[model samples]
Target: MTDIADLPFAMYDAFTDVPYSGSQAAIVLNAGQLSTENRMRIARQIGVPATSFVDRIEGTTVSLQFFSTVMELPMCGHGTLCLITRLVDLDLLPCDSDDWHNATLDLPKGKATVKYRRNTNGRIEVMLDVATATFAPAALDMDRLATLLGITPDDYSSSLPAEVASADFIHLCLPLRDLDAMNRLQPDFAGLAAFCIENGLETVAAFSTDVIAVDRHLHVRDFCPAVGVSESAAAGTTNAALAAYLFRNNLVKPEGADLFEIRAEQGLKLGRPSQITSRIMVSDGDITRLQVGGIATRVIEGKLSLPSPDSGPLSQQ
Candidate 1:
């Protein structure tokens, strides 16, 4: 009989400085021996917004898989951020060394890049290279949005207009007017979930570029209960999609500038306020890179013995 091994895991609050705030992600390092079912079982056990399983392949490069307690995802931005930051926090990488500031992620879909750096203020920030933020026209059901999110058409207007934006999966970009409307949101979960199915969408991001808080270029919220994520406190991909939405419309940068940064905030209503910064690299009129990063702190660590092979087939909780 094969021995069931013990799997160790750690949880980190990503995109925020405060503990128990931000969107928490669980990480399982060196999980090469585990099966997909085992990873899914482990993710369900942790009960975080998302859980990542990492299999080390070489120095600064690892194969990663993300789960939402329901199913596996090709990639997850916050989960990736937590893994990169945890590597630094655990001193698994020479985070302070110039040569050790970068890492490559091998996801189910493809390879992604990440860089770690400390600002002049001595705060550590992890930057992801998602080069995949892109946009295409989206056919939106405005009435369904209003019925589910309680946002009247006049409550907000999108400068960039609605579209399917992607850093990972396609997210419907719904630009609102300001933070007040976001804070007042009480999304109808059942209705929203149905909308996602009927429309073949997993998530919709509603945001306001008009800053309600000083220095925050955007205030946003992402809903994805269709894929089992009711809400995400701070999402790396969602913010990247927002930046792409803004950039395509010529919103943030000067006429000829290439590099740009956007300050953003989310999760205020849940009280787990998260701050994220998105980096944009435009080679011409086209954006060549989409990266989002922020501070993440470790909160919990534990180990669990895997289910016995003799046990019945596993199912998500």
Candidate 2:
């Protein structure tokens, strides 16, 4: 019989400084030797929308694999943020507390950069620089989208139009008139899932400029039913896409000549309030790069026992 191994894992609520709020993700340490099947099983057992498997930590570079409850994903934004926070909190990275430290993430989709440092409040701040997304007008019917979200056509924002944005994933961006419209959203999950799959979309991001916090630029709610997540408390990639959409449509003005920073709030409806900071770098007249980052709070730490190879079918718990 093969000996079972125990893996250490930590759960974190990403995109919030509070302990229990924000989106939750699990980071499995020393998961390099685990097989793909084992990784999938582990993710399911963690019971989170997304889990990060640490493949290797080499110098200032970390290789990671992300798996959702259902299947593997190219990359996970909140998961990456949580992993970076955990690494810095554990003192695993080589860095000085006062200065910003740069790290590279080797993901299944591609390589990205991360900058982190211990802030004045003694909390770690992680900034993830990801690929700049491209936008295309969605061909889907507006009336159908309104019905799918259980909202009326009048609730849609005329100023900010709908578009399909793609970064690491594809998102259907829906602009609503106000926070009341955002609050009234009651999506048909099964129908939304089918709609996403047929439309080659991943998530539906409904957003409004009216925010709860005076400092926040936008408020968003992301629904990812196709990936088995009915709604995400906080989604970095989806927010990044929203940021790009705002810039592309000239909705937000740059703070400086070449940089624009957006404070986005999410998850109030779910009560797991999250804050995401998205930074956009513009060159000449076009947006060049996008970065999403946030503070994460560690919630749980435990060990997971690896299942034996010869074990029968595992529980779907």
Candidate 3:
């Protein structure tokens, strides 16, 4: 059994420049002293979409783990970005040089590396070579899907089709025909939650390429009540899966070779607009890698008193 300790935690709004606009994640630093149960308890206590717990190994490399309100996740893009931004602000990640710095993150998926450099815009551009997204045929009942989305079958895009994709987590991709359909989408939380629990679905990302004028691939909205998020302004893993879907469907064709960058706009309907960029590396007609990059702003800085393992669940704290 490990002893109880008061940990330092910070809140960061990722995928948006302004705080409280993007997805918020709680980060507890130097959390190596906490056990798995303790970590989960702290995350639940935080009661956010996700919580990132980091144990600084040496220099910039560390063991980072993500926990949703329900369970510990394999990887979370927004969580990672929030932690990096917090670290950079705290001087844990040195800057001021033109050379790009690398940090090794030991995640459940694998050892993933994050590269960061102070861009010309004065923002710390952080990018992670996340899980390679893959697609699978979705055999979904149109009626059932429509019911889950709380919309009529005719509202869905007949051309884009529904498909399943995964990078860090599996996502059911629904391409809408226009922004109105995307904005008016309302998921039956109870029904979709039950379906997700039964089928192991992490999230449902709805997007439309018909909204934005130019320089953007799509306007996206995510519903993940299954994973405890009713609606997310910006999601890293979910957007990466969307990028892979676009490439697989040839919606975002390569310039000349098998490479493409997709810029996405999300959370506008929620009033917390976000800018998310994804890079796809393809080879032999297959997506080799997918990476999501964005900016994050720290909102709150303080320490949290974690509950002692002997005292019981943190809900009581």
Candidate 4:
């Protein structure tokens, strides 16, 4: 067994009741000595879409950083949610007591407060208060995007034009006309990499309404070669951006309620079948607040050894 002192961390994948179904990442709670290079190296070694490192802070807040396999990002929803859940699990916070209801996370972009609550079924659910979304028009290179995705221009939905939106990082939203077209999408990762590099896009969110039940709506499928995520099972920030897209385009009529709730179904094609619930408040056509919540299941817990910074690549370890 590896020495506990050398391990220095525990990791978990949230929102997946089944093992290997949802996204996974490492969690470094006491990230005092770890440098950015080390973090990225570990994240790349783990091979998950995003990993989180936490530094305890004063009050109910904790400092956090998110890293993908190749780079560090401003913020990540799933990684943030997983870190908070792990905190509660480790007894780092009073998860079983009343004090567990709220905790704040200090991310690179800003402060993101998380709330924990139990549903009627007695399952733990987490809610992350995220930043408001911003929308701007960008030339939709349908030919290039479709070429990279191996789809045609006719696949996109007529009601919604492809555009870039942001809650944390920028993502291009492409609404497909049907589920078949959405399913038919087989992206050329190399092509997508080149397209995103030249176009300055971080990610592409391609979705269809065919899977959406009229009673319960959903935001699905976050594919980004830029971030090295082929398909994100559940992306809260993207959901927030979708909500803003809906409200801005008058797709959903918002009355007195500032908050809008919707279900996000993802990982179906991948056979994981995950669900995410998101809520956002918009006033005067401006998003004021956003929150994404879901249940998390602990799949695996283990430790890994790393080479010292001077030891060159981790593969040697």
Candidate 5:
């Protein structure tokens, strides 16, 4: 057994350029040698929604593992962005002569493409190439759904129906009428968690076209209790799914081009106020490419003390 030591870690607020304005994720450096149990223990101790362990960096390929306080995850969108930003900030993925540097991420599900480059102000900009989103109509009762969100059925948007969208994770895509309904959301965390688990979902992505910023496309709030978070400030996968949902319903379409960009505002109610960007490329009425990206600010950098391995095995909640 390895002796207890201070494990180096960095926390970054993802999906935003300013610190403390986005979702937080912890990136544990040099965590390749840790056992799965140890990683889980560390994740629980960190108590973040998502924690990334930097396993290895070989040339242009980076191996990473993501864990929540409850269990291991196949992939994490915000976590990936934060991890990439951390790598760049540490000078591990230094900028070259080219405008952008491309890398591959070794995730538990599969390999994913990543592009990063330093902006004019030298802040690292990272974009993750996510899986093409596919959606299925959800059979949830509108009344029940309304009760779940503490809103009335009349508050739902008449434009789009509820759906289960997938792009690495599953989210119940719900549409609200306006920002007022969004501001009145009062989710039953326990009930939401139970519903998510029963439906094999990760989050309920509530979005509206009524955005505060004129340039933004949607205002979103992600409720994810099944995966251990009550509500996410900014979720990568959920926003990617939201982008596809809009495109599928013809809510947003490209008139003169095949690529349509989607900008979403999230976490405002939580006071984090994250901006998430996604692009969808269409080819002959079919989605061909999907990408989500944003900038992150490093907030806390320090070492974490590992619990004694002999104390007891921590079980997933």
Candidate 6:
């Protein structure tokens, strides 16, 4: 039997200063001995959209795995942010040292380097410098999207056009005319799931900039019924992709600004309002780097006791 005390884990809500506003992710700091089935079960038990397992590997590199409620993902934004925040909070990440400001994380997808910097407000933000965005022309059924979202094409006219894009994961982008159209959304989960399956997409990101609120320029809703994430608390990768979309269309002046910043608010209707702030640096019509960051609040900390290998009929709750 595995000792429960040694299997302790910590949970944090990323992207929010408040206790429960951001996306919740579980972190198993020492997951070296856990099996794949055990990890999936633990994630499902946690009931969050995603969870992260961190294992200290050779010489200052940690191996990380991100798992959704259903399965493992190649990469995830909030999970990465949550893990790095925990590391910093625990003093595991060297803060005072000059060379410690930046570190490379080995994820399932590839090696991603993150830099820690303090903003003007004295808030520490972790910038995960993502690779270039990948775009390809793909067809979408706008009517199906409207039907699933309970909106029409007329509601999105002012936003001008919709398409499919993938920064890390492929999502169908539907631009709405105003926040009112977005607020009116009540997606049919089953319908959306079927559509995603038929179209070979991951999620549908319906967004608009017409709705401006405190410290925010855009509002977005990410729906991923296919992966069992009906709605994300905050989606960092998609928001970064959105920044790329804006710059690609020349909608924003990216060069002269301190940083091209955009705030994405989500999970409001579900009573778990979360916020994600993303920035990008563009030079000579090319995005040099991308950073998505936010605060993380610790929520729960506990451990799991595994049954003995010889124990009969292991029980799960």
What's model 3's lDDT at 126?
78
Per-candidate TM equals 0.90, 0.95, 0.91, 0.88, 0.93, 0.90
Candidate 1, 1-317: lDDT as tens digits: 54555666789999988899999999887787678887887788788879988777578787778999888987777887788777776667656744428788888788888888765555567888775556777776787687799777666574557788765676888887666776667899889988888887778888887665788888888898887788889988888888877877777864336888887888887788999989887775777777888878789987766655565354222
Predicted candidate 4 versus true structure: per-residue lDDT over 141-201, tens digit per residue: 7887888888888887877778888657788877888878878888898888778778777
Question: Lowest-scoring 10 consecutive residues by lDDT in candidate 5?
Answer: 308-317
The top-ranked prediction according to lDDT is: 2
For candidate 1, the TM-score is 0.90
RMSD per candidate (Å) reads 3.0, 2.4, 3.0, 3.2, 2.8, 3.0
Candidate 6: list runs displaced more than 4 Å.
1-5, 57-60, 97-100, 118-123, 255-259, 308-317
- Where is the poorest 10-residue window by lDDT in model 4? 1-10
Which structure is stronger by lDDT: 1 or 5?
A: 5
Q: Per-residue lDDT for 263-290 in model 5, tens only?
A: 9999999999999989888889998888
> Tens digits of per-residue lDDT for model 2 on 1-317?
64566778899999998988999999998888777887898788788989999988999899989999988988788998899988877778865766888999998778889998888988888888877788898899789878999999999998878999988999988899999999999999999999999999999999999988999999999999999789999999999999988888888888887999988999999999999989999888787878998889999998877755455433112
What global local distance difference test value does model 1 have?
0.79
- The CA lDDT at 136 in model 4 is 78
The residue ranges of model 3 lying beyond 4 angstroms of the native Cα positions read 1-5, 255-258, 307-317
Could you tell which candidate, 1 or 3, scores higher by lDDT?
A: 3
Best TM-score among the predictions, by candidate number:
2
lDDT of 3 by residue, 1-317 (tens): 54555778898888888878988898998887677777887788888888988876678777878998888888888888888878888888887675778988887668888877777877777787777666777777767877788778777788987887866788988887787777678788888878766766778888888766477888998888888788888898888888878887888877668778988888887887888888888889877777888888888989887656566564232
Residue-pair clashes per candidate: 0, 0, 0, 1, 0, 0
lDDT of each: 0.79, 0.89, 0.81, 0.72, 0.86, 0.74
Give stretches of model 1 more than 4 Å off.
1-4, 98-100, 118-123, 158-160, 254-257, 307-317
Residue range with the least summed lDDT across 10 consecutive positions in model 6? 308-317
